[model samples]
Target: MTCRIWGRISSINVRKVVFTAQLLDLTFERVDAGAAFGIVRTPQYQQRNPNSLVPLLEDGDFTLWESNVIVRYLCARHPERGLYPPELQARFDAERWMDWQQTTLNPAGREAFIQLIRTPAEQRNAQALAASVAATQPLLAMLDARLASRRFMAGDTLTMADIPIACEMHRWWGLPLEHAQHPNLRRWYDSIRSLPAASGALDVPLS
Candidate 1:
């Protein structure tokens, strides 16, 4: 089945799906649809994804949205590839980190990213930036502790959990903030950075 992803290449959320597709060796087409491209708001695009968000995935007759959900679908459908573990407990453990990324880390990272990259220098809010950094530190520390014990977030094997968290980690580290030392996290990130998909998709500079 041919896969098409609608989103700009630079979006971290889009990057996660793109990386997952690449990891699975799935051939896909990507169309620029968000931000500067302005295609996401079109009527036809709205029909496919009413939210008009980037990273909408179309697999022949099947359509999916939300980057994390798309990744899960891709992994579950291709179980032998081992992207998503079959074990219920292990899968849930991996999923917990993915949820944490959405519920906790992304909000904090988005604040810092907007202030540092999107907002103009003259209008940037130092107070907001500081708050974002403070909110993100504890999460990074938690990841650090996890990485200290395991080679990957959920365990030694790389899983769906790594994709979203890695995307956010790239953005977090890209910002010009004084971050806490997380040696294990740094090491795990560096290891993933060497992977072909990560080197191509997750290594983009913060926008």
Candidate 2:
């Protein structure tokens, strides 16, 4: 069944779903309906997703939200992609990093993106921006340590975990912050940068 994915192209959350769909090579349609293109508040859209968030997925009659969950759903349709592992521990290993990106990485990482790119220089909060960058560094260090041997988040292969985290890294790296280098994280990112979906979506300027 063809899926209908809704979100603006520039949204990092939406990029996660887009990359997952492209990686799966699934038949789908993407509807622009968030941020400035505001269909998310429409009555019909709200009925489908009351949260009014971008990156909503509709597969036949099945609807899903939260970008990482949408990635999981799309991967389920094409098990051969190996992006979502079936084994319990392996699956959770992917899920764990996915959750950490949302709860830990994104929160800290978004600071510099917003302050430097979104906020005007005169209006920027220098202290909070610096603190946010500081908070995000050790988290990248954590992933660096994890990637010290493994080529990907879970193991040697790409999995659902890397989708959201990669978007987060793209945001962090794109900004002009004086970031502490995470060698292993940089190594993993360089390897994945060649993926068409990732190159097309995450390589864009931070917005």
Best by TM-score: 1
lDDT of each: 0.89, 0.87
TM-score of each: 0.97, 0.96
Q: Highest lDDT: give the candidate number.
A: 1
Residues 90-147 of candidate 2: C-alpha lDDT, one tens digit per residue: 9998999999899999998788888999999999999989888888888888999999
Off by over 4 Å in 2: none
* Residue ranges of candidate 1 with Cα displaced over 4 Å: none
Backbone clashes under 3 angstroms, per model: 0, 0
- Against the true structure, candidate 1 has what lDDT? 0.89
